[model samples]
Target chain A: MPLPKDETLIFFSKPDNALVKAICGRLIPGSPEDPGAVEAGAHQYIDHALAGYYHSQRTAYRRGLTAINAYSQSQYQKEFVELSNDQQDSVLTDMQKGTATGFESPKAPDFFNTLFQHVREGTFCDPAYHGNQNLVGWKMIGFDGAQVAHFDSHMQVGADQSERTPILTLADMEELNFPAPENGY
Target chain B: MSLPKVDVVIVGCGAAGGVMAKELSTNGMKVVALDRGDFLRTRDVAQLDELRWQTRGELQEPMIKDTQVRWRPDEKTDTIGLPFLMASGIGGSTRHYTTQHWRMLPHHFKQYSENVARYGASAIPVGTGLVDWPMTYEDLAPFYDKVDEEIGISGKAGNINGTIQAGGNPFEGPRSKEYPMPPLLQSTVSRLAKPVLESLGYNPFPGPSSIATENYKGRPACTYCSFCTSYYCFIGSKGSTNVTVLPVGISSGNLEIRPNVRVIKINKDSGGGETTGVSYIDATGKEQEQPASLVILSSYTYENIRLLLYSDINKNGMVGKYFMDHHYPFVWGYFDDTVTNPSTGPWAANVAIDNFNGDNFDHTGLGFIEGGVLEALGGDLQAIAGAGVGSWAVPMPDDTPSFGEGYKQALKKYFRRIASFISQVPSLPYDANYCDLDPVVKDQIGMPVLRITYNAYENEIKACAFMQNKAENILKEMGVAKMKKAGLFTPPTTTHEVGGVRMGTDPTKSVLNKYLQSWELPNLFVVGGAVFPTYFGYNPTHTIEALAYWSADYIKTQCKPGGSLTQYF
Candidate 1:
């Protein structure tokens, strides 16, 4: 098992890295106005997870990602990352619908689902886990992140109370002086 | 090697077994309880990480081949097995459970008789194994009250005695008193659903839970943390058995709960009619035996049934038949304005209506015999989970892509605005759906695992659709912009597993007697959801505890020195 260092590709090769970045960008694409999975470093999460918890899916990633690029070349005469946005989306639709050919082991739809689930996890998971970079994902979607206690006051919210009750995280609990659990989490 | 004799030996210290350990030992009976897992506390495994707890299953049981069950949709299909989600430690799944405390409706206890009297015998579905419980709601009523006060439940009283009480479940059977503590604070969904339901002539109230609203019985009050379902209580507010009964049992000095001791077999006498003691593999992996006058099997439903068959105690082949579980149906919608931050508060918090549950409604011409509890599922939705394409069995709406800018917009809409709903509809037992020893699969210990063959009966399928329709109606009434209806027959992750070794009046048809005692062996008692005569659309923990108290009372008085164990027989 390879461990990921900062900016290091532990599981993905240089070619597969570009493929992952391209796929994740399309999975939850956004502009600078509203950053999404790509801006949240979801591909980095996938790289980190594949090195550790999701090590079993390494072969599946290799096969499915390779199959996807191969299918892209067969259709558009270019690699997956080089396709136009419209063309890329069309290819992804065929993959999701399981209509795309040159896929085995994990069918096209299965691979799409797995990749989509991971991309979502990368965008929405806690900042400590490498995704949700700079808390941009939570900010974009207006989510309350990892709050332990939601008293009556917490429920009754006015306009964005980011100053008083900003979106908190597990990492913020210590420095922000949130009450530690009696069980010492 | 055989150890010294004890008065009783109980196996698998879980929801039912923990109660036995508390009740019998307090009554001066020397008891030894063996558990295959550790006695974990909140301090041992407290975290708020969804990836660790809910996704990766940090607190759930590992799928050991020995305890795994082979599952098939029906007998015609090949089996695919996953270890059912259950906790192994002393508190069992209760440690991480959402703590929805409930009592069975009066009709639920006598379903067969009630159905026949109300709709005639022809209304009964074919090949169904429905029966009236040997005991009535009246029999279990006092014990349910015991669970409320002793175990620390929080809710209003819908009805006290014959008088109807406000703010509680009016459909609940007559209770002796109100809940031990007041109900938890309402979520936005609970507040929103109240008047809409009342205007539509439905009673909406806070769901009864075992979490403390006030500082009851020395535990702190609940913190309204949304991480209640899969995560352990960081502060011991929730009434898990580890924090409640087992500690009290330990203080008495009459009970010994040995963890990491796997009870493999219930040793039988020469006649094979009575149990002598149990053989267990201790923590060091050394096999040992302990002699006892009485034996109680109080594990989870699966293990209680599996151990009986493994021990060859199925004298009449009634050991692992009539397997049953719940089939959950979900419906949800998105709001334009209301910010019901669903990622806060308790998992089962907020408003629920039991109007469609059990036989509460007239089944006449409805094409279904029973229904389920429909609730405002707003509070339990996690923000991170809402971002996923298909978390909580709810995928994006029809024709909506699960990716790109559209998917990103969908997540933002689903997060703060969605008010979800679901029903815990129960499946009935058919002769064809049952569990037996697997032919090909064996555990690491070379023990054949249990194989479960189950399929929803026509009645249950109809019930699932009925509940889904009801949920959709409630959502539509609440005035939602975009609605989504999940597919029917989504397998239940909230495993309210019940039935297998059923209790009945007839010895040939049941494994245990009315008191949950084995028919052939008077000294052997089996308890838990495994002995449920029929399934009800409610959580089974309170019922399991009530039965333990009832049987322990019998063992104390009637099965003691001057009394005969087989008096009922």
Candidate 2:
């Protein structure tokens, strides 16, 4: 249920769009044996949020992405997505520490915090929001999602309920006759 | 447009307003209660969407459409936007509250006199506007019992007529009887913490909750859905005003609830000595006048302050001074063997150790004058909320990576293994921590927003550190492998914000009288936590309800058909 290409391209340009994907991948880069933000469709989630819930932050994203590119070019003489993994991490580290130059208005640390929070939300939120595809994020964190009832037996002290049952989501709740939200507020 | 005059017109039909509407209408007084938000049906809360209700605050007043408040830690710094943690609809914050209803200890009401007597007058902090409440706990106890019975609060009474009871909060103020309902079932975290607290000789008891444990008043018991905090209960188990008081008020046939209207000002006489009615804008942007013989302001703390300031009703310049909130600090424990099951029960303090709260323990040499309650809580297991450092139950430690494979592994490992103890510390009022109209910000309707100037004082910070140490000790005694102390020095977070239009015996130092009546304007009665003289360790909802009932009774007897207000004064 990822956003269509036409809708995804509305929030960011092609180059900045690829840069978001690259940043999310580095923030939660999973191994070949495990799932991460990339597998959870965090980039698509960010795109969806930018077009809706986080629409007010569009200006900050644009300014922050441009400043990040400028800082990358000055440091590595290349675009952020084109840099090596280590180089990209270094540039992001600078931004996180608020030491990256050329960032104004939104500032570097503020932008980093915003992007970090969005990436986390995209990774962990219910898949009905078009993220957490296949419940990868939930599996990664051992979170048994959306148990409407029957948690008493599993939630006992010293109980190992982690491997007790199959995980559920908001989508499953709809099928199980449990009330789910019809629309976002 | 002009509406027909009623006997009483109450603005903001939430906790206090709900009680007022019920009492006045049932007593045969025609009442009109206006609320800015809709009276949501139970179906509206049937869905369990943590992302929508908890994280995004869908049930709360939207900052974009509502008045967005501003805040700065200190007066010298530039103010930043802060969310007013209040709900707007029929129930106000009571709709989405955790329902951790608690009656304030007797010592809380007499903090000023008690501290002065114990440690002498010079022990009082220089800038702290510490004062005894106009009324005592004894004066409000009957009303407290009334609210507990009417709202069906569940708890074991600790003190009954000065006799200490077993397996209950022994430090509690004397009560005539037990709670209306039994306490909610204990969670795994509470079970684990009980032995540890008892070993330390701290009296551990079940926290009083407004959520029903058994069928009461035709409403079903709590389902223990874990969506208890920050989300409405679909089963009508939580004793919110919408489910309990408002319905009774409407059933009386004398109460008229007008929703989706904003009261802009409390209209007064030409001489500005008494309130005549109120001017408001309807949902369709039409200005209307709702004239009444008596006007009661029962909105949240911020709104009560804002309306008073907006109406230019600060005759003694004490309209929005001494704003306070319980400066909450959390201590978390990571146990490898124990499954704390942080997402199980009513999502409130299930078990609390009251030995350290209020004046229960001596504050003799402790630099601070007040202390706070320590408790084991549950149901903050939402994923997105737990990902952040300061916002989570088991937050990422300083050494842990912000994200990556390591972060994912840590989250999985500690998801059910982490338990936290939150310290609900008492906050004394300070002259510097006050609220005024923001010069730069305005609401969606072009009204100036409230700007809060507050910071953690030395007393509060020291109390927080002391409580954190105590929490850490308890966690260690519980055999926690790893522990982290999180003492927050941020903006006012606890929803127990109090003391804006504070009540006092002296008119020069207060806005409301002992009966919560406006000193300058006799017909205007202000209710809610806004009239609290000081913030206590416990939640303010029960106290607020009791005060509202007390004020309603005062209005019932003193302002009835032949009763005279002059006689009371």
Candidate 3:
């Protein structure tokens, strides 16, 4: 009953998904060569998070996505995701600077901050929610992933150390090898 | 229905609650210890996974639907989802915290008096509510040793009875005992920092940690799992109460623990003017009243004050008055010439510099009365969420900026080559910064949840700026390239949450007395960091534990007799 998986995304529809991808592209822009939030399963993770750990997190996400769309219509007369990358950047920059207004918004500062925070969180959080797939985040940063201990050859320090003693380190997962570009989805 | 009565009703099972339970129960006084969270074992926690807890803040308090509160200048609850952060459940915040324990330096006790003597009182910040604790370091020293030994601290004692060590806190007051375990493994980052620190004439010591270096008592040694701060110890290795005290207390037969029982109020007998018992909601949503002769508010600082305020337990309504937290800021740099695996160790770093802590520095022209230590924490990249792996603090492919084709090159070149250092500064209590019931918001139980009011003082800001400079200097000495000093350090956070029901000699100015006795009702006691009259320049758990043991001894010896209130010892 405590929900099977860790994160279940709540408020995202198909359009909302496109908006999150666009916003995340701006926040933690992924190049074509390197897997970005979209390819890293950020959209899927967001969907799961809304359904999982924070169900109410969806309400805020919905409010934010709706506001971005409404603001886009008034500013550039286009949907948020449909705008040119530069145009989208301009809108985000305005929002970040607290210059944007209207759209039943809870102040531009809070809106931008909440939106930006969620996107970043969705993209960079543990891949268990479906984001950072194939250990994209772990491998890119040389994160070893969660291991039982630091008991590997790397942990062989000064003698008098025991063999059965575990050196479980969160930073040294054996499977967290850096991804080859060709192998990525 | 008739319920069993006991001598003391201690709420929570964390550092303070555990100490009170052990001390009071072992003293042969019957105790009914209640915790509003589930019981967690050390082995149960040691099985944590990053995908489950760490990145998601899962180990932290669950997000109460629309229960989040915020404090802007106007005291607003208008914002729908403001991050009103506070960890709840049995051990409260301590259950999922990195146990980086450090005893407060001697001068932290008498900050106001000493600073006023050294520098004019005018040097104190206008807005800050800084004050000297009613008790002194000497008063708390013996208890510090007792708690350190009982709970098991790990570090080399820098100063023992006037003898200074080659490394360790030379500024520390005389200690009667040594740590239970040796210091943890110093990482490559700390190794590189040593010569640079010595070259610059500053001593860097392996920080005092509750993480065991050797198997002590029943708990195992730290596995260096690197999932410390946000994750529970999967191996039962860390010195959290689940591993150290709770089990011991449970086996004693004198101690009775009831987890998942939410304390609604400290039920006071209106006629007798003494605390009769507490009314709590159990996990099954049934209300029950547990009676006791004495009550100790051992919950975290916020809950300790909030429960008292909600129950109106204190006569003068001084609960939730002096909320304080350590204002931590960061200064990070990128280094090119090293194999710095920033993410392959415990959450704690090895090097700590206490040179600027408390009144260690001359306050001649300084705006702040108190100062704080500057240190570096070695971090790891277990997930992409925390992955900023380059010279320019570049985020992962989708974690930060991937502007153009050139940006791709930047990520590959700099991801593993960069390391960062952070600064931890002391935060003093302030008059404008306090907590009270919000006029608008209410919790699930319909009690008005606490409303926090805080803004950084000029002195705190100045202190942060100073600590930043010191950290940058250390980074520079360590041969870091592009050591960027983070600017502004805006919107002081609620991480180190301290003082609310502040302890003082006068009942009018303080909620609890020097012995942690409530001024209105002598039988009632409030322990934990909430009773701290002033904020010291370190993590508050160690001091809170020492104070709990000290106060428990007083309760057993003198206070239980029902005699005069003015007696000391």
Taking the candidates one at a time, how many backbone clashes does each contain? 1, 0, 38
Candidate 2: where is the Cα deviation over 4 Å?
A1-15, A175-185, B389-394, B488-490, B565-569
DockQ, candidate no. 1: 0.39
In order, the Cα lDDT scores of the candidates are: 0.79, 0.81, 0.67
- For model 1, the docking class works out as acceptable
Which residue pairs clash in candidate 1?
B66-B443
Clashing pairs in 2: none
The 10-residue segment with the lowest total lDDT in model 2 chain A = A176-185
* Tens digits of per-residue lDDT for model 2, B1-569: 67888888999988899889999999888899998888786666676666667767776755336888788988799998766667788887887898988888999999999999998988899998999988888999999999999877998889999999998899999999999998878888888889989999899999998888878887677767676677877567778888788788888899998888999999888999888899998889899999988999998888899999999999899988999888778887888777776656666637898888888888888898878778886554766766662233257555567665677767777766777788888678999989999988888788999998888888889889989999989889988888877765547656677888989989999999999999999999999998988888888899999999999999888865577663322
Worst 10 residues of 3 chain B by lDDT: B389-398
Q: A-chain TM-score per prediction? A: 0.87, 0.87, 0.70
- Candidate number with the higher DockQ (1 or 3): 1
- Order of the predicted models by lDDT, top scorer first: 2, 1, 3
Largest TM-score belongs to which candidate? 2
Q: Judge candidate 3 at residue B370 and give its lDDT.
A: 77
Sorting all predicted structures by DockQ, with the top scorer first, yields: 1, 2, 3
Question: Each prediction's TM-score against the native?
Answer: 0.93, 0.94, 0.84
Return the lDDT, model 3, position B182: 87
